[model samples]
Target: MERLRRRLPPLTALVVFEAAARLQSFTLAAQEMCITQAAVSRQIRQLEEHLGNPLFIRNHRSVALTTAGQRLFGAVDESLERIAQASTEIRGDASDAVTIAATICMSTYWLMPRLDAFQQEHPNVALRLFALDREVDLRAENVDMAITCGSEGQRHGVRMAHLMDEELVPLCSPAYLAGRVLREPGELLGERLLNLDREHWRGFNWAVVDWAAWFDHMQVRGTLPAARLAFNNHAQQIQATLDGRGIALGSPRMLADLLASGRLVEVLPQRLNTRRGYYLAINEHSTRPRAVAELQGWLERVSHAAMA
Candidate 1:
């Protein structure tokens, strides 16, 4: 092992190189590996230096593998696949459960309500759910499935299916509306608006529609009103909106039940559709498991029905 370690470049760098070569884009590789593009470049550079040979021809917008890169990629890809298969066989079905990872907001507002139906349909399949609010690596965490929200370009190298596009609209409890009329977007300037604390999510790079962006989209020119309240978590912000604290920009997919039950109502008729949406991401290593496949199919059917 020591001799092999000295003869080879870092295993992590090899993995990163394989992703970059396979995807043909550092940006895409970074997204797939859950790292920064610069980090991917750095790892590739280190591997190249160790081998004393250039592996990639870097162009302005894309990268192409050199002959040496092609050879190394073939070897590394096969070795990794074998390792993954061996690991799976060794682990076997000792812990048989379809483990799913998702954002806290997604788990609470979107997924939790539908779980009972899944249980009823597949009674013998045990399930484990992890509600995380930060970025998670499906491979590293050994998650069978993940509910991810992002732009199309950002999601690559995974068997994914479209769930729903992000649709945002101003929402408030009926109590806050209280026989008042809000016809124009400008009228919202007079009401208390709930928002997410930008400082709290500084690292997450959350690009959700804020009051300023919503106003710009509506062509309401002027200084935007300050937020009446702000919370670090989306779930908290949603709870405040439900409590009639203020109107909030809400996603119908997340608040479908509330809107249907009349607990939350759209303040204005306008809805903003962004290019981003939710998706079901299946782990590449776990695709062969029967339970994983069943859950994936269920999610697709359920999401499609909801979107319809």
Candidate 2:
């Protein structure tokens, strides 16, 4: 035990040092590791002390690696990367598959339809999908990849790729909207407004997509009937709208099939841009397996084609 301790620095210190060296910022490394900046600095200091050399030269408001630090970082990075790669290879052999976490609506409305094509292209890869509403920790959950709706602004230790920009518009069955004199946005006041109470709706700013924002955006005044039925799930709200329950603010991509099938109609042709858009997030520490890499490539290609 004593010999081991003498031969090696603490794993925490090594990890902290590696992250700081890779990102070139102690603060960012701290954020990625879910630790304080001070803690990261202390760990790096400890690592430098153990090695009997200065790792970083403190410049004004920034840091630069010393020659010894650069050499050490290269060795440490390669070693850690190899360990991660080996672990992923071991895990991949058991399942020989990729696991993707996505929202229920995305899975049902978007991915399910195109899954056959993906399978056809990569027959050997098994794609397992988890349809969920809540955000998951990829590391803790063992999720290979995840597609979620958000701006890639503040996420750390995850590689985020922008998929598509989503536009929201009010929609209802054409039969339901027929004979309802709706010349202006204010006319929606008398209509039943189905509510989708999800995280995506947070940016609506009116607490609900009521007549207020719609009318305000259209430069009109209107009142909407109190929500008769509210659903926390977007799929449920959309399904309710399809059944002619009420008008719902629908995502263009989510309701594309229903609209094409004549099961639903856009109440207003004008689309509203929301703060959220679909993003592909991969955990930084997790090595992308062969199947996962293939799926990620397919998703990027398909999403880009749809947008184009």
**Could you give candidate 2's per-residue lDDT for residues 1-308 as a string of tens digits?**
98987799888899889889877889878998999999999999999988899999987677889999999998888787677668767777346567788888888888788889999998998877899877766754667788887677655456788888777888898778776646656677778888865455565322344445655677765555786888877778878888889888877776667788888888878777766688888866555456677888998998888768
User: Model 1, residue 104: displacement in angstroms?
Assistant: 1.1
TM-score per candidate: 0.78, 0.69
**Cα lDDT of model 1 by residue, 153-232, tens digit:** 44433577677788889999999999887899989888899998887777663455688888888899887667768887
Off by over 4 Å in 2: 6-88, 91-94, 178-181, 198-212
**Candidate 2: worst-modelled 10 consecutive residues by lDDT:** 203-212
Query: Please, what is the whole-model Cα lDDT of each candidate in the order they appear?
Result: 0.83, 0.78
